[model samples]
Target: MQKLKDRVAIITGGAQGIGAAYARAMAAEGARVAIADILDGTSLAKEIEAAGGRAMAVQVNVADETSVLAMAEAVNEHFGRIDILVNNAAVYASLQLKPFSEIDVAEWDKVMAVNVRGPFVCAKAVVPFMRSNGYGRIVNISSGTPFKGTPNLLHYVTSKGAILALSRALAREVGGDGICVNTLAPGLVLSEGVIQNTDMREKLTGPVLASRAIKRDQTPEDLIEPLLFLASDACAFMTGETLVVDGGSVMH
Candidate 1:
């Protein structure tokens, strides 16, 4: 459990939900974590401290290269090294299932900016630090809907698809450097941003339990153990793998 003793980690979009869970789990396992998100990461850091673990809050907008770079610098300056990174920040558009013709270009671009470019920039910023240190662990979060093709969330679905592939390619590129990169694709996790709206909940979950073998519903807590497994010493030999933790709902 203390395999990550004194190891510093960066978890983007780590202020709440699954990201928050990972932050706490990593800290519990002796990793000093930096909760990086556009949202003030103060509360998450405080929680870690309350639990007797070390943590810091770094404000980062993953879509912006400057913000991502500065976050990496701040984490390094505070912790002296970065041993792990979990790219978990994400966003969804309000637009519904429509003909591709009716979809707004601006909305599609917004999704790409955050979902795709954000992780890329964050990875680019931290890899150099990891390279010099000779060890790194990265877990990029994605959704399973893309693999099954959700009709409504075109933007959200496609972006996750891209992240899955990106994690694999990135793994192959950096494996020799002792960096293990992988993707954690979660299903219908209930988060603050998600369940707040009735419409959003209905849309995200309608196809989830109905088509799956399991009759149980999934919550944000469902993913904590898996997140811990990858962020800790357990994932050293696992790279370029998409660990689907969707309760057998979506098989790829």
Candidate 2:
């Protein structure tokens, strides 16, 4: 059965990498997906439609309230309802790993804007639509690095930690309205973006693999089922929960 049959889902950063994986997974489950991203996602949307799944691409800077609001409007207009939101847009692969002291102030703010404020603005833009429908699912993408206290990327780790707090607080505020907010924390996966960054892939992969109980590289496919559960009716009774899917690395 199609878990998300007829549901409308908005996936930020859907143009590439893990976000693209989420888009494909949701589309395959019968959701009409809106691929929202600062990058061009038109090709991916076309690809999904060609595969008999419904999708549309919309350009959006998740950190900008106006841009995010416009994106929500576009999706609502095209799909007629907003059922789920995957807050997956972030600044990670592009970052050059460095000690906290060496991190530039401007870079730190940029990371916070996209990693933290992005989700906040996105949720703000879409909540009214979800509230009107009396139903919604918000899956905020966080990371396992924060729990492990991973160094050399303090800003990235801190922003991901904020997502946990954001999910819980938002879940509490929206629970009565039948809106579910949760966090999905994934370990380092060799996504398209990560693969292109040789520094990130080469430096972190071996150590991350050693840390995992599974003792294998995590893939985008590894996250599909967990994402489906959170975005579908299967997770109706659950909110404010952090479902970590990092191959049992950080058993939180």
For residues 210-239, write the lDDT of model 1, one tens digit per residue: 876776777777887787777767899999
Task: Quantify all predictions' global Cα lDDT against the true fold.
Answer: 0.86, 0.96
Deviation in angstroms for 53 in model 2? 1.3
Q: For model 1, which pairs clash? A: none
**Which runs in model 2 stand beyond 4 Å of their true positions?**
none
Model 1 / residue 124 / CA error / Å: 0.4
**Model 1 score (lDDT):** 0.86
Cα error, residue 58 of model 2, in Å, equals: 0.4
CA lDDT of 63 in candidate 1?
94
